[model samples]
Structure formats: structure tokens, C-alpha cells
Target: MRVLVTGHRGYIGSIVTPLLRAAGHDVVGLDSGLFALCLLGPAPENPPEFDVDLRDVTEAHLQGIDAVIHLAALSNDPLGSLAPQITHDINHHASVRLAHLAKNAGVRRFLYASTCSVYGSAGADLVREDAPLRPLTPYAESKVRVEDDVAAIADSGFSPVFLRNATAFGFSPCLRADIVLNNLVGRAVLTGKVRVLSDGTPWRPLVHVQDIAAAFTYALTAPTDKIHCAAYNVGTEANNMTVEQIAGAAADAVPGSTVLVTGDTGPDPRSYRVDFSAIRSAFDGYDPQWSVADGAAELYENYTRWGLTEYLFSERFTRLNHLEKLLAAGVLDASLRFQLIGAGCE
Candidate 1:
């Protein structure tokens, strides 16, 4: 399989691209290089790439590509809320457009990186893939839109599979400290505290980055009948944990670290447990290996080994802060498009 992975330089993409290559698939990349400098460690091995933004991807970029693992977007709730229209433009409109282009260009497989957050405010019930989606934020709303629009275009030739991944955590070369587990670990390592601002009550489904990469790799070659237009929630049910539990795990991983629930952000409405049985049964021999404690430990080790700092953790590694900084510095325009001189603005 020859795969074209969008956001191949991103936190998840950096891990996914290499995993695809190791699985004997020829991998190419398409990224705007916005987060190219947000590296926590040594850079990953390069693949044949189109240095193009997701919105600017042309037919030429899709030419000769067998499949597309779409993972690029303005990810996270804060970023999406900051500019809802831009989020819709890129995450929803551009994503559906890419699907149409891929189908027209004869790309067989389209594995979209959807999120479990679409089952927003489902309370304690274990929401499955067929559950009614109640997206609480612009980011989750955009994902819901993409899944609906893209799945509508599925056909005999073009297979579109929606992998609704849980809140991703774990260390990547292109590290992200924005997500739950990573953020907790980083705070514990830097400040010796695992702080939760939302009363630590929201339920979150968490998955390690490597597990997510493996799930996608398997879906790439999964039988057409099984994966065609199917939606599967990635991650294990065992990993569905509350914010308090996650913080405790992080605190355990970092010696002398204490868990603190400030309750400053108030009660969060974005709470839901997800049922991952659909994906587990569909993908034979596939099960998420890392637990919250293990992932927390892994993150703590990596953050310490890589010399994580308060400034880097708070700003550069957090996606919302990083992009806002870019916009303020004029490196990215108001639309989040690159405006840097000689940076190949399209």
C-alpha cells in the first residue's frame, strides 16, 4: 500500500507515518509545516512529501496515492472555539473536499481521524459508534460533520472508514502537551503537581499514540466489506477514566507529586465513556496495550529525558497557545495560513 498521510509532522502523524512504513507500506506526507519546529526530540525520518496545507491540497498531490490517512486540522476545543468558522472550513469543508478528490483520483482507502468527543455529554453511559452524536465544541462538531459528509460519499470503489479515536496521550517526537495524560505528566514533572481545574470529574477515554498508529495501519488494509463506511471508536474500554484517576496515575509516575483538583474551571460538560468493542471485534488480534498508568510513566520518562521546560510545556507544546503565538507573530494569518516569507505560502 502506498499511503499519503496528511499532518505527517504532527504529534500523531509523526508516530503514524513511521509505523505505516514499518508495516511495509510506502508512505508520503502532506503538511503545511506550521508545527514543523515543535519538536521535543530528534526529527523523524522524512518521507516524500507535498509541503501543502490541507485546504490547499490539489489533485496533483493526490495523484498516484493509494490511500489517505487524513489527520490534519486545527485540533483541540480551545483552538476550535477561538475561531469556529476557520475550524469548520478546514476540519469540515476541506476534509469532505479531500474525500471527493481522493475518490475521483482512485484512492481506495480513506481512514479519517475522527474523535470520541463527538459523543459529548453522554454522561456515564458507554456510547457506541451508532450513538447519537452531541458535539459540545466546534472541534467535535467539525469532526461530526466530516464523518457524516465523508461517509455519505462512500461507494464500491472508495472505502471510507472513520476511526473515532479517544483522547490521545503519550510521547511523540513532535510532542503535544495539550492532551490530558501528557499535560498531567508534564505538570507533575515540571511543577511536582497533577492539577485538575475542572473538579476532576469529567470522564475521558484515553489511548496511547502508538496504539492509535497501529489501529490506523490495520484499518488501511482491512477487508473492504468490514471497514467500508464503518465507524469504530478506537481505544480500549479499560482506559476510560475520570480526570481524577488520570491525575492520580500521573502523580504516581512522578515521585513526590500530588494531585490537586482546583475546581476553578467549574463542571465540564464534555464527559463520556466510549464502547470500543466494535473496533476490537472488527480488527482481529488488535487490543490497546498501554494502560493509563503505563502511559503516564512513559510520558514522565520521555519528558524528563527530553528536558521538558515550563515555558515549552505551557506554550510551544500546547496547540492552542502555539497557534495563537504564531498568529500574533504574523507567521500565520488570521485564517491560520502561513504568511512567513520564503515559507512557501500558497
Candidate 2:
């Protein structure tokens, strides 16, 4: 299989790209290099990375490719909130156009990386894939819209698979200290404490980066009839946890981590957890082996020896954050800014 992965140098893509290669598929990656994202560490190695925008992709750009794993976008809520219009442009409009173009170009299969955040306020610990979607943020909303666009490609006999991934916790080759688990580990190592910024009760379905990679790899090989226009929530149902629950779990795994309770604060709209029954059913019991605890421990152990601790702690590191860059650029409004400021924009 000749696979094309966008954002291939990103934290998730870094893990997914290697998995695709190991499975014997010839893969090419398209990325902008967004050099600023290297604040956490060095770049993840990937050749044939296009210095292009997803909004500007052409059929010529995709020449010789058999399929596309669309991962490029202004990822994260703060980043999407940066310029709501730009978010729609890149995340939705361009994405829809890409699928249409790919389908027209005879690409065999297209895999879209969606988010569990689309099921906002599921009001339950385990929200299934077919559950009503209640998107809470521009980022989540954009994902919801694109899923429809990708699904539409099925009319043309193109196989489009959607993976609504869980809250990824493990460190990536393209390291991001912006995620909850990595952020917790980074804060504990840097400031000796990790905080749950909100009331710390938000439910989040968690998964390891490797597990997500495994899910993508599984989708690549699954029979076309099984995955076309299908949306699967990639995670283990038992792994659903709360914000403070994850912070507490990290405290248990990291030797020096002291989980801090900063008092009940504001309400975060990003509080819903997700269900993974669809993915499990799709893969027929591809149970994830790595848990959030395992990922937290790995991040901590690596931070202990590697300079990653300093890398994440540095003020300069903020400049490399895509989400932070969006805020500094005033692409986001004041209200969204206030909420994400404490999230490390996490």
C-alpha cells in the first residue's frame, strides 16, 4: 500500500508513521514543518515531508499515492479558536476539498483522524460512537463537520474511515507537553507540582499514543467493506477517567509527583468522556495493552534522564506551541483565551 500521511511529523503522526512503515506500507508524509512546534524537543525524522498547507493541496501533490491519512490542521481547541474562520478553512473546508480531490484522483482509502471531543458533555462516563454529538468547542465542532464531509466520499466508492481518538496521553516522538498526562509529568518535574485547572471532574477517555498508532494501522489493513464511511471511537471503555483522576494516577506513578488541588475554579466545557466499543467491534477485540499509568511512567522516566524536563519548563518553549502561538497572535477571543491559559493551552 502506498500511504500518504499529513502532519506526519506531529506527535500522533510520528507514532503512526512508524507503524505504517513497519507494516510494510510505503508511506509519504506532507507537513509544513511548523518549525515552532519543536519547542518541546528536536523534530521527528520523516523524509518527503511537504512544506505545504492542507488548504493548498493539489492532485499533483498526491501523485503516486494510494491513500491519505488526513491529520493536518490547526490542532487543539485554543489553536482552532485562534481564528474561527481560519479553523473552518483549514479543518473543514480544506479537509472536505481534500477528500473530494482524493476521491476524484482514485485514492483507494482515506483515513481521517477525528476527536472524541465531538461528543461533548455525553453526560456519562462511557459515551458510545453512535451517541448524539454535542460539540463544545470550535475544534470539536470542526471535527464533527469534517466527519460528515469525509463520510460523503463513500458515494463515489472511496473508502473513508474515521477514527475518533481518545485523549492521547503518552509522549510522542514529536513531543508535546501540552497534553494532560505529559503536561502533568512536565509540571511535576519542573515545578514539583501538577494541577487540575478546572474543578478536576471532567470525564476523559484516555489512550496511549502507541495504542492510537495501532488503531490507525489496524484500519489500514481492515477489509474495505468493513470500514468505509465508518466512524470508530479509538480507545478502551475501561480507560475512561476524570481530569483529577488522571492527575492522581500520575502522582501514583511518578516518584516525585505531588498532585495539587487548587480549589474548585471555573467550568470547562471540555468535560465529556467517550466509548470505544465501535473500535473494538471493528477490530474484533484489538484490546489496548498500554494504560494511562504506563504512558505517564514512561514520560516521567524519560524526563528524569532526558533534558525534556528543561525543554518543557523553558519560557521559550511556549513560542513553539502551536496553540500558544495562536493565542499570542490574537486569533482567539478573550473568553477562550482565559480558559486555555491555564491548560498550558493543554
Candidate 3:
């Protein structure tokens, strides 16, 4: 399989790209190089890439690509809230366009990296792939839109699988400190405290980045009838934890660190317990092995070993803050597109 992985240098993509290669698939990359400089450690060995933005991807880039693992977008709620229009432009519009182009280019498989956040505020019930999608934020809404529009374009030749991944944790070379587990662990490592601004009552299903990579790797060659226009929640029931419980795991990972539920921001509405049974039933061999406790420990060890600091944690690793800084620095324009001044952007 020759695959074109969008956002191949991102937190999840950095890990997923290598796994696809190890599975004997030839991988090509397409990224805008927005976060190319936000490396916590050494840079990763990237695949041959078409250094272009998602909105600017041309038919030439899709030539000879067997499958496309679409992962590029305004990845989180805060990033989406920061610029909602751009979020829709890139995440929803560009994504649907890519699917049409892929199908026309003879790309057999289109794997979308959707989020479990689409099941926003489902309370105690475990929401399945067919559950009511109540997207609370622009980011989740964008994902929902992409899934609906892309699935409409699926046919006998083109199979679009939606992998609705949970809140991703664990460390990658292109580190992201904004996610729940990663943020809590980083705070504990740096400040000896795990602070939860929200009352710590919102339920968030967690999954390790490696496990997400494994899910995508499995989806690449899975039976077309099984995956075609199918949506699968990509986290185990075992990892469905509250914010306070996640903070507790972080505290346990770091000695002498205390968990603080501030309740400053009140309760977060982006809470959902996801059901992963569908994926398990389909891809029987794909079982998520990472627990919240294990992921917290892994993040702690990696953050310490890589020399994480408070400054970098607040500025570089956090996507919203980093993009804001880029915009202020004139490296990125109003629409979040990189200026051609930098070598990476060029």
C-alpha cells in the first residue's frame, strides 16, 4: 500500500507514519509545516512530503497514492474556538474536497481521523458510533461535517472509514501538551501539581498515541465491506475516566504531586464515554492495550527525559498558544497559512 498521510509531522501523525512504514506500506506525506519547529526532542525522519497546505492540495499530490490517512486540521477545541471560520475552512471544506479528489484519483481507501468528542455530553451512557452526535464546539462540529460529507462520496471503488479516536495521550516527537492526560502530566512534572480547572467531573475516554497508530495501521488493509462508510469509536471502555481520575493518575505518576480540582471553569460539557465494541468486533486483532495509569507514567517519563520546561509547555507544545505566537510573529498569516519567508514553508 502506498499511502499519503496528511499532517505526517504532527503529534499523532509522527507516530502513525512510522507504524505504517513498519507494516510494509510505502508512505508519502503532505503537511503545511505550521508546527514543524514545535519539536520537544530530535526531529522525526519524515516521509517524502508535498510541503503544501490542506486547502491547497492539488490532484498531482494524490497521484499513485493508494490510501489517504487524513489527520490535518485545527485539532482541538481551543484551536477551533480561536479561529472558527478557518477551522471549518480547513477541517470541513478541505477534508470533503480531499475525499472527492482521492476518489477521482483512484485512491481506494480514505481513513479519516475523527474524534469521540462528537458524542458531546452524553452523560453516563456509553455512546456508540451510531449515537446522536451533539458536537459542542466548532472542532467537533467540523469532524461531524467531514464524516457526513465524505461518507456521501463513498462507493464501490472508494471506501471511507471514520476512526473516531478518543482524547489522545502519551508522548510523541512532535509533542502536544494541551490534551487532558498530557497536560496534567506535564503540569505535575513541572509544578508538582495536577490542576483541574473544571470541577473534574466530566468523563473523557483516553487512548495512547501508539494505540491510535495501531488502529490506523489495521484500518489500512481491513476488508472494504467491513470498513466502508463505517464509524468506529477508537478507545476501550476501560480507559473511560473522569477528569479527577485522570489527574489522580498524573499525581501517582509523579511523586509528591497533589491533585487540585479548582472548579474555576465549572463543569465542561465535552464529556462522553465511548463504546469501542464495534471496532473490536470488526478488527478482532486490534485491541487497545494502554490504560490511563500507563499513559500517565509514559508521559511523565518522556517529559522528564526530554527536559520539559514550564515556558515550552505553555507556549510551544500547546497548539492554540503556539499558533497565536506564530500569527503574532508574522510567520503565519490571518488565515493560519504559513508565509513563504521560512525555508520549511517554502
Give candidate 3's whole-model lDDT.
Answer: 0.92
Residues 178-223 of candidate 2 have per-residue lDDT tens digits of 6788788778877778787788877888889899889988888887
Candidate 2, poorest ten consecutive residues by summed lDDT: 336-345
Error of 2 at 116 (Å): 0.4
CA error at residue 62 for candidate 1, angstroms: 0.9
What TM-score fits each model?
0.98, 0.89, 0.98
Residue 45, candidate 3: Cα error in Å is 0.6
lDDT tens readout by residue for model 3, 1-346? 9999999989999999999998899999999888776888788999999888999998889999999999998899999999999999999999999999999999999999999999988998889998999999999999999999998988999999999999999989999999999999999999999999999999999999999999999898889987789999998999999999999999999989999999999989878898899999888699999999999898888888889998889988999988888788787889988775563311
State the weakest 10-residue window (summed lDDT) of model 3. 337-346
Model 1, 6-74: lDDT tens per residue? Answer: 999899999999899888999999988878778887889979998888898888888899999999998
Q: Which parts of model 2 are misplaced by more than 4 Å?
A: 35-43, 309-346
- The clash count of every prediction, one per candidate, is 0, 2, 0
Higher-scoring candidate on TM-score, 1 or 2: 1
